[model samples]
Target: MQVIATAGHVDHGKSTLVRALTGMEPDRWAEERRRGMTIDLGFAWTTLGAETVAFVDVPGHERFVTNMLAGIGPVPAAMIVVAADEGWMPQSAEHLAALDALGVRHGLLVVTRADLEDPSAATELAQAEIEQTSLGRIEAVAVSAVTGRGLPELRGALARLVAGLPPGQPGPVRLWVDRSFTIKGSGTVVTGTLAAGALRTGDELDLTGVAKPVRVRGLQSLGRSVGEVHAPARVAVNLRGVDKDTITRGAALLTPGRFLLSDLVDVRVHGDPVAGLPATLTLHLGSAAVPVRVRPLGADTARLRLGRALPLRIGDRALLRDPGRHHVAGGVTVLDVVPPGLTRRGAAAARALVLEQLDGVPDVAGELRRRKLIRGSELARTGVDTATFPAPVAGEWLADPAHWAVLQDRLRDEVERHAKENPLEPGAPVEALRHRLGLPDRALVEALVRAPLVTRGGRVSAGGPAVPGDLIRAVETAFEGLGPFAAPEANRLAELGLGPRQLGAAVRAGLVVQLAAGVVLRAGAPEQAVRRLAGLPQPFTLSEARQALDTSRRVAVPLLGLLDSTGVTQRGDDDRRTVVRG
Candidate 1:
C-alpha cells in the first residue's frame, strides 16, 4: 500500500480532487461538509493499478496549519493541489516549506480546478517555487475534478509518483498516530501512516508519553483487515487495554525496547542554531508537533527539551517553528537521542566536544568507546541491533573490544604481580581486582581470571607453585607401592622427605590420600573400598568394610567418613553405611 497527503491553499479542491480520484467522500464531519473545508484530517483510498494508494486530505487554512502538519508529517509521498485560479498562494509555500523542513522529496505537483483557468501557468509557477526547496523540480499534472479533465492521467501519475519514491525506511515499528477514537464494539482504534517497520495482531507496543504498553487486538492496512501490516502505508490499529481519550496526535506506537524515549535531544540544525531558533518553539516530526525549549551549543548544534518523552532516532529531521515569531525556523537533524545534563561548569563545552565526534548516523562504536563500559539495556534502547553489534566483555555490559582485551591483559598482570609479591596469601581478593580495573561490575572481574591465576575461597592466586616437581615424582613412586587398603607410615613418608606440608599439597593436588592422622593410604583406596563394599551387603558396618578391604580401624574409620563426605556412602541410623553406586 502507498499513502499521499494533500498540500495546497484553502478551498483549492484538495479534498475535491481526492473524492474525484477515489469515488468516495473525503469529509467525515457535517461542519466540514457545510463549511466546504477540511477542519481536520480525512482519509480516502483508490486502487492505482495493482496497488491501493490511500489519500490523506489535509486542511489548507492558515488557522489550522498545525492540524495540517499533523496529517502530512508521516506520509512519505504527497500531492500539492494548487487551484489554477488561485495559483501559488501563501499556504502553498508554507505547506511546501513544512515538507522541505521534513526532507520530503517524493511527491507530485498537482494543478487542480483546471476548468476555471488554464493550468499551464499555475503549474509552471508552482513547479518553480518547489525547485527552490528540498523538493526540487517536479513535473505538474493539470486536472479538474468538475470536468474530469486529466483524471485518468492524474491517477497514473500518482501511481508513478509513488513508484519513483525511494524504498520505505527499514527499522522496527513506529506508527505516529494522527487520529484516535472509540467504536461501539471494537474498543479503541488509532489511525496513522505506518511510517516505518511492521506490526502484527497481539504484538505489544510502547506508546510514547504513556507508561503502559498497549496490545494490537487487530490491524487494518488501507482499510482492510489483516493479521499484520508493514510500514509506509495507512494503518488503523484496533488496540486493547487503552482508552481512546488517552491517545492523541503525536503519540507513537513502537516496537517496545527498539527505540529510545526521552524528553531531551541534541540536534544539528541546517543553519546557525543560535540565530535560527526561538526560546520557545514547536517541534514537528513524524506526526507530532509539540512545544519545546532549545539550548544552543554552537552555530549548528543545539539541545531540545520536549513537553514530554518522545521516541526519535539519530539523523531524524524535524521542523522547528516559533509559533509567536516565525513559522519555520530551521530543520533540526538529531545527533543524539540521549544527551547529557548540563548542570556542571564547562558541561556545555564538554558536551560540544562529544557532539563533534558524531557523524550523520549514530556512532555506536564511538559511544561504547567513550563510556568504556555501559549497560546493554542502554545500548538496546539506542536501537542499535546487538545481533550485528560488536561483542562485549560479558553479557549486559558493553565495552570497547580492544579496551576489554587491554583489561584482560591488565588483570592478568595484576594477578601475576599479586602472586609474585604475596605467595603465601591467596592472590588478591576479588574486591581488590575489581577496584584495580575501575570496573563497577564484580562479575567482569571473575570472568577475566583463569588458569595459572586460579580462583577459590573468595580469593585468587597462581596455582600453588605447580605442585613441586620433586614431590610429584616422590609421591607417585611411593603411592604405586602402597597396598589398596593399607596406608603409608609417617616414618616412611619422612624417610622420603615428605613433610606435612608436602603431604597436604599432594592431597589437594589429587596425587595422594590422607584418610586421617597416621592413616595415609593409597590414592585410589576409596574407589577400591566402594566397589568391595557394594558387593558385600545391603548395608555394611565399619568391621565389614575393614575386613573386606583388609585395612585397619585407624584407616577404615576415616576412609568411611571420607566416603560419606564425598557422597560415596549414606550412613544409616544404626551406624552402618551403604554404597551410593551411581
Candidate 2:
C-alpha cells in the first residue's frame, strides 16, 4: 500500500479532483461541504491496476496549512494541485517551501480545472517553479474534472509515482495521531499514517511523554479491519484505556520503551533561516507542530526548548516556522534528543562542535561513549552499523571500544590492589568488585578478568596468593618419608599450615593430593593406587582391593572414586570394580 498527500493553494479543486478520481467523498464533515472548502484532513483511496493507492486530501487554505502539513509529514509522496485559471500563487509557494523543508522529493504536479482556461501555460509554470525546490523536474498532467480530460493519464502517472517511492522508515512502530474521535460502541479511535514498523491487534503502545501504555483493541487500514499492519499505510487504531480528549493531534503511539522523549532537542541548522525567526518558533515534526524556544549554538547548530516532549532521535528532520509570520525560518536536523543545558561559558560552542560531526549519518560510537548504553531497538534508527561499532559490551547494549578498554584496564588494576590489601583472603567479593568498577552486568566484569586474574566461587583472585614459601617447604618435609598410600590425618595436616582453604588451594596448585576428607597423601599417591589396583583380579570387591593396596577403606574408597572419575577404573553395579581399558 502507498499513501500520497495533496498540496496546493485553496480553491485549486484538490478535493474535487479526489472525489472524481476515487469515487469516494473526501469532505467528511457537513460544515466543510456547506463551506465548499476542506477544513481538516480528508481521506480517499483508489485501486490503480494491481496496486492500492491511498490519498490524504489536505486543505490548502492559509489557515489550514497546518492541517496540510499534518497530512504530508508522514506520507512519502504528494500531488501539488494548481487551478489552471490561477497560475502559481502565494500559498502555492508556501506549500512548496514546506515540502522542500521536509525533504519530500517523490511527487508530481496536477493542473486541475483545466477546462476553464488553457492549462498548458499553468502546467509549465508549475513545473518550472517545482524545479527550483527539492522535488525537481517532476511530471505535470493537466486534468479537467468537469470534462474528464487526461484523468486516465493522471491515474497512470500516480500509479507510477507510487511504484517509485523509496522504502519507509524501518523498525518498531510509530503512528502519529492526526485525527481522534469516538464510536458509539467502540470507544476512542485514532487515525494516522503508519510511518514505520508494524502494529498488531492487542499491541501495547506508549503515548509520547506518558508513562502508561495504551493497547490497540482493533486496527483498520484503508478503511478495513486487519490483523496487523506495516509501514507506508494509513492506519486507524481503536485504543483502550484512553478517551478521545486524552489524545489529540500531535500525540504519537509508539513502540514502548524504545524512543527517547525529551523537551529539549539539539539540531544542526539546515537551509537559510527565512524571515529571521523570533526567539520562539513552531517546530513541525511528523504530524505534530508545537512551539519552541530557539537558541543558536553556532553557524550550523542550535538548541530548541520545547514546551512538551516529543519522541525524537538522531537524524530526524524538522521544520522551524514562525507561528505569527506563518513562514519557515529554517529546517533543523535533530542531532540530540536530550542535550545538556548551557550553564557555563563556552558550553554551547563546545556542543556545537560535537553536533557538526554528526551530519547525514549519526556518530554512533561517539554517542555510545557519551551515553554509555543505548537500547538495541533504538540503535537501528541511528544509521550506524553495530558490527562496525567499537567494542560493544553486550548484545542488548552498545558501548564504545575505547571506553571499554579503559574500563577493563581500570578494573584489572583495582582487583590487583584488592589482592595486595588482603593477602590472606580470596580475591575480591563479587558484589564489592562490581561496585568498585561501577558496572551493572557481571558478564562485563568477567570478560575483563583475564589470565592470572580468575573468578571462582563468586570471587576474583590474583593467582591465590604467592603459595606461602614456608608452608610449602613444611608440607614437603612432613610427607618425605611417607608411603604412597600413607596419608596425613586432619590434625596433622592443620599443623602443617594447611587449613580447609589452604589445603584446597594446595590441591588446586598440584602441591598435594586429597584422597579423602581428613586424609590427604603425597602428590604421587593416585598413580601408586592405580598400579596396585591393576595387579588385583580383573573384577574385585572393595575389601579385596583395599587389602591388596595395604590401605583402609577410608583412603581406598575416595582414591578409587578419583581413579574411576579420571577413567582409570570402572565401578560395577554389583558391589565390584574393574579396570577401564581406555
Best by lDDT: 1
Please, what are the lDDT tens digits per residue for candidate 1 over residues 126-240?
A: 8989988787887689998999999988988888897887666777888999989888999999989987788899999998767888999999886679998776788899999
Model 2: runs farther than 4 Å from truth?
167-170, 273-277, 340-344, 360-366, 369-395, 416-443, 456-461, 466-582
Candidate 2, pairs of clashing residues: none
lDDT scores of the candidates, listed in order: 0.82, 0.81
Q: Name the candidate that leads on TM-score.
A: 1
Q: Which residue window of length 10 is worst by lDDT in model 1?
A: 419-428
RMSD of each: 6.2, 8.5
Q: Which ten residues in a row have the lowest lDDT in candidate 2?
A: 380-389
**TM-score (C-alpha, index-matched) for candidate 2:** 0.75
In candidate 1, which residue pairs clash? none
lDDT of 2 by residue, 1-582 (tens): 889999999989999999999999998899999999999999999999888888999998999988888888888888999999999988898888888888888998999888999998998889989998889999989999999998999999998898898766667677899999999999999999987888999999898645689999999988889999888899999999887888879899987766777789888766665225478888898889988998887776778899888888777888878768878766778888767778999887788787777774567767777766565555654444445555445656666667777877887888879867754455777778878888777766776687778887677777754455655776786676766676776677777777777777567656778866667877877887777878887888889988988877778888888888898888888968888753
Model 1, runs deviating above 4 Å = 168-170, 375-377, 412-424, 450-454, 457-582
Model 2 residue 172 CA deviation (Å) reads 1.2
Alpha carbon deviation, residue 484, candidate 1 (Å): 25
